[model samples]
Target chain A: MQSEFAVELRDVVKQFVTPEGNLLNAVDHVTMQIKNGEFFSMLGSSGCGKTTSLRMIAGFEWPTEGEVYIEGKPMGHTPPFQRKVNTVFQNYALFQHMTVYQNVAFGLEMEGADKNEIEKRVKRALEMVQLTGMERRKPRQLSGGQQQRVAVARALVKLPDVLLLDEPLGALDLKLRKEMQLELKALQQELGITFIYVTHDQEEALTMSDRIAVMSKGKVMQMGTPVEIYERPANRFVADFIGESNFLEGKIKSVSADEASVFVPALNAELSGVPMSKDFVNGEEVVISIRPEKIRIVDADAEKDGVFRAKVINSIYIGSDTHVFLDCNGVRLKVMEQNHISRLDPHSFYHKDQAVGVYLIPENTLVLKKEA
Target chain B: MLQRLRENKAWQGTLLALPTTLWLFVLLVIPLFLTLVVSFGRRSPDGGVIYGFSFHNYLRLIGYSTNCPAGQSACFDPLYAQILWRSLTLAFWTTVIVILLAYPLAYFIARSHPRRRNTFLMLVLVPLWTNFVIRVYAWMMLLREQGVINGVLGWIAAQFGLPFQPLQMLYTPGAVLVGMVYEFLPFMILPIFTSLEKIELPLYEAAADLGANPFRTFLRVTLPLSMPGVVAGTILVFIPVMGTFIVSDLLGGKQVILVGNLIQNQFLSARDPTFGSAASLILMIMTLIVTYFYTRKFGFGEEIITA
Candidate 1:
């Protein structure tokens, strides 16, 4: 039977000895399955093994243990040229001597494609990347974005089963990076080829990936859809990494099948939320995590059961939103309150030394078992 | 003192460059100018410069010897012309063979494991640590009629019950060519290795990702990228081989006579400094012309050359 996954890493471990002679797992025993036609991303900071995992899938690296499967075939130390996958390197490693057209035609010619076919496909691939009139320009003559497109075209002209991109847009300016992110997403969907993108930018991963695998210290922490990853992060690391979260030390007051109530010492109260990962017994120490935007600012006079009186410490206006820092029940909490007005209104914004009420919705608040 | 010099950067640079400038001007430019002046002067009766303008030396170089039996003003003699031609061909062939021999070794060292790469590069440079003439003498020891090679071959032939004869391997044009190739091989290898090593690892992976096998990658990526290094090595090897005389003198045993040997003989035994000056100027011009065209086509491969 045909496999559902375009690529699968089963208990993959890539070990490396440091220059200091310490054995380190560059990629731990991590297992993940990327489905066909999915824009899957391995996202993390540097040394997180995301790039290593991508390299293993691209066949640039081999797993020290377990196997990597591409299109239902176990890739046992297969060299990169023999594999049916192409890569867009982080540096956009275009052959400097080859022109844009030749860069795109390289794969076809290597596969022994006919001259006319190579020309036709090269032209089409350039057009797809909107680099049609730059056939004769060397890679040095093109801009970073154009060079990136050439790298993509060079890989995609082969019509591989999958395309692996390693931080392809990390070098571009912010505006161009954002534009290319959408363009790459559209291209992936249009061609319906699996794209395995590796990036350290969480926003890029969240914005483009159909599913994301957040990794740290060579281990896969969580793999889920964008909404799932952002809304229900797996643990303290994931919660702090994906976006932003406020962690308050707490202990479990009550535990249900999925929901749990944690008594936070900071607020001297209990908050209920669904447990993010495993089971939690009563009196177990936990972390009550909530995003900055999840907390609500209430009227001081409002009668809310979960409202805690707070003093506004500082407010920073960042055009789209106002960041309000409040001292609530001896814990400093940050609140990202969206601005509904067209322009900045200092009167609407909370000034320092003003009294306010802070309320945490139990559903938005998360309980993470604190690591030792 | 450094802080004071830093206040005027251009002055500091001039001060820094003073020694090399004085050295080149006194040793190189003055000698070249003197050679140019002497090339135009006539030979004195006492075998010194007569200090008179004449075109005889230049004309005589192009086969116009006035000392013919007919007492002619100018006549053709193919001896010097033949030596010049032979030198050109020898330099060209030596450079070609050295490139063919150097590229693989350079590529091997460039592709070797990083920890051992320095060791391989050192091995390539080891022969240079010996004095250049001594190195040539070492080749002579190997290529002489009863040298180690022929002795080994004769031993093998005797064991096989075949007639054993010492081959005439010494003092031939082939011996000179071998010596020339051995002497200049390192110059070519070093620059080529530098250029090949400068090609990042990602480039090879990018080629492989594009479906290029190792051979195809070498053909398309490795070969083209390393052209700068090859050009640099060619400049390093070809110019020196053209003007070099020691290997030819020691190995050729009068069988091979290049422009270098011609110039040397004219200034020394022949006692004709004017002719030597003209020949030296001609060699310099030829070397510069080739270098100009070659660099225009490729590049300086500046890193290693400047270093």
Candidate 2:
């Protein structure tokens, strides 16, 4: 039976020896399975081992422990040329000495394909990236965005089972990067080839990935869809990393199948029906995370079970939303309000030090385990 | 006045180039112009240049000679032409051999670890600390019949009870070629190493990812990218090898007579300043022609240094 995964990393670990005589685990024992034709992303900041993990998959580095497999066959020290995979490097890595057509045709030429066939595939690949007329230009003559497209075309022309990208658009400006993100996602869908993209950009990852593996400190924190990862983060790190969250320390008061009651001493109130990431015992310490947009500033007389008094310290009007900074009994919190009304009314803005009642919607709040 | 001059970029450029311009006019331009003039003038009875101008020296340099016996026309002499051709061939071979030897050593040094790479580069440059003539003389010592190589071979042969004869390696074309290659090898290595080291590590990975094996990667990626260095090193070695006479004089002895020896003999031994001036002008013209065609094909070697 054929394996469902196009690429699989089974407990891969890579260690590097530092100049100071210390052994460092650049990539710890990490396992991941990328489904066939799925756009999988590994996301983290610099030095978080995300690139190291991708390199292991590309056979640039061998794992000190465990193994990598492609198409259900173990890749035991297989050199990169023998592997049926291609990479779009961060720097675009186009051959500077060659024209765009030659760069795109290098792979087919190496495979000993007929000259006409190579030329036809190279033409089609360049056309796919919309670089048809610019075939004779050198890489140094192309702009950054154009060079990135050339790199993508060069890798895709090989028609490998999997394609790896290491921050392919990290050099572009914001507007071009956003446009390319959408275009790359569309291209992946059109080609039906599995893509393993590595990037530190959370927005780019969330925008294009079918599933993302959030990494920190050489370990995968969580792996799920964008909605599942952002809404129900597994731990304090995941919640804090994926999006902005105001964490309040608390102790578990009651537990159930899908909800928990947390008694937050800072807010001097008990939050009931809070969504739980895991079942916790009563009297166990935890942190309750609430997105700023989820917590609303309601009228003082509203009848809510989880309503608490807060004093607004500052209010920032940020075009689309107003960020209201509040102090609730020595615990600082941020609440975001969308500007739904028109004409910039003075009555819509909250004054400084105005006492208000904040409502914490039970289902929107998440309870996570405390990090050491 | 200084502020006004600074405001005008043309004036600023002229002022900055003033010293070098004057220096070139005094040392290089004036000497070359004098050589050209002397080449056209006739030689006096006491080997001094006379005021009359003619094409006698030029015609004589290209095989026409004036020492015909009384009624016949001027005869053809192939001595100087043969010397010039010999010099060209020797320089060409020296450049080719040096490139073959230096390219691999440069690759080794460039790919070595950073700490060891520095040591290797220093080793390549260490011999240059000595004078050029001294280095050539050292080669003479090794290649002589009674030299260190023959001495070691003699010892080995005596131990095995074989016939021991000192081979004649000195005063031959091979000796001169060996000396030229040894002396000019560093010029080739340094530039090639610079270009090779400037290549980023990711390009190799990208090539392999594109299905190129290691040998194919070197042929397509490494070799093409390092052409600027090869061109620069070739020019640096070929030009010097063409004009240098010390290595031939010390190693080739009387067997190898190049154009450099011809020019030296005319000026010093034969006291024919006019003939020497003609030879010098011809050498300059030949060098310029070759350099022009070379640069047209491969460009100025500026890219290797900048890269």
Candidate 3:
């Protein structure tokens, strides 16, 4: 049986030495495990050390502390070329002098494969990346997306144990990026190789990853599946970063094993949700997060126990849906409603400066413990 | 256009270019053309060209100087061919030496940390800021017997209790080569540095990602990308080295004679304008042929030829 983790980093720390002899911690104590045949993503904002962590795993960087292991073997001081891991950089870094065929064949050449085997493998790798028949063209002659595909083919041609991609599609256009995202996901599944992808794009992580480690300030903020991260985030940073949400300051009014009631200071009412964090005492300060789509809009005349009244401040007709901005108590809340058959012209019921009531889905709203 | 010419802007550009273009034509091109014309003419006793045409200068260059006096062997002799051959050989060796030395230095300047790179390049160029003659003269002092180098060698030999006579380092072919390399090394470095600087680091990283080691990456990627600089630097160093005279005149004493020395002797000491013109024309033709092949080999097409 295969090992549980294909790539593992334990308390990896990387500090860059300045010319004046000061050290700046670029990657600080990052520890994570990537499962075999899984598309694992490290998502974070810029300068958050996600790429540094990925480089450490790829053997391009040596951690200042702790070790990086791949396939149950210690990669103590291995160079990047000697490691059985390949990287696809953000800029697609294709060799400008070589043709596409030669770029893909470079690794096979290094492996000392037979002439026929090298040609066959290079062609196969190019086919995998859908870059067949353009083998003779140099990088400058190709489009950005094509260059990116060639970079992928160059790395994938090595057939390493794990493939590390540092925002590989960042250079492509939106349409091309989306297409490549799907292609990358399909390719990962078909090849069944461990893929450790790094990106600042949450949508990309949500779309392609089997599991994601959300990073911030050189630390892993949370790690879980897409649905788990979206439905039940660990903290304010993860919740606010992964998706759109409205957070309200509150205090716990009643605590239970599975449920809790938090009194919202802004609305002057009690809000109920599943307590996703540690134990909370009564009257303890807490925060509640609720997705906009989970909140339902009701007319003022319609009476509902869980409904709270809100005034429509602004409304936008976005092609497939209407984005309604409402003032709940003193705070503004955005609500997205679909233009489905059952909800035809929902905005017709309300206009700007008109009052309406919002019903929050108790199950969708989460009560997170107050972070220091 | 004539209409646009009336706008005065055209005249301004023409005015700006007038002095340099006229200088080049009158001082450089006209003199060269005069030399070519004189190459086919007979020499008057007064050291001016006679309008009569003859193949005597060419025949004399091929060692048919029988009509010339035997005592004037230094002025009209078969040594011109040997001088040309030696100049070519020395220039080739100098080009090779400078290129090997400049490559690593250029690569370091191009790829090292930006804050220190400028300072390093400036240090390399500091010696060039001095007058060329002064710099060559400084080498004379350094290489002379009982100079700074000899002082150091004598001191080291004294510590070992060995014979301490100053070594024969002055007025030799070796000293001339040292001066030539020192004078032309910067010309080789600057172009190579420019080309190396333009090579993106991502290209090397991509090569590594494709499983190539450092050596293979340099051979497959960096070397090909920087060939333009290599070609430019080689020609820049080689052509001038072949034509240079002062370094050899000062450092070589009477030990050697290059093509440039022969050319100078023909026009000055020999007072033979016809023979000098023939030699100059031959050199010009040889340079043109070599340049054509060099640029063509490096894939420089109309761009370099026209430039």
* Model 2 RMSD, rounded to 1 decimal: 2.5
Q: Enumerate the chain B TM-scores of all models.
A: 0.92, 0.93, 0.86
Query: What TM-score against the true fold does each predicted structure earn?
Result: 0.89, 0.96, 0.91
> Compared with the true structure, what per-residue lDDT tens digits does model 2 show for residues A9-77?
899888999899899888888899999999999999887789998888788999999899998889989
lDDT of each: 0.90, 0.90, 0.84
How much is the lDDT of residue A73 in candidate 1?
A: 93
**How do the candidates rank by DockQ, highest first?**
2, 1, 3
> What is the two-chain DockQ of model 2?
0.56
Best first by TM-score, ranked: 2, 3, 1
Candidate 1 displacement at residue A353 in angstroms: 4.5
Candidate 1 structure quality by residue, lDDT tens digits, A193-277 = 9999999999999999999999999999999999989988888899899999888898888888888988888888877664555
DockQ of 3: 0.41
lDDT of 3 at A211: 99
lDDT of 3 by residue, B16-74 (tens): 89999999999999998888889998778988788667877777665666556656543
Interface RMSD of each: 5.4, 4.2, 5.8
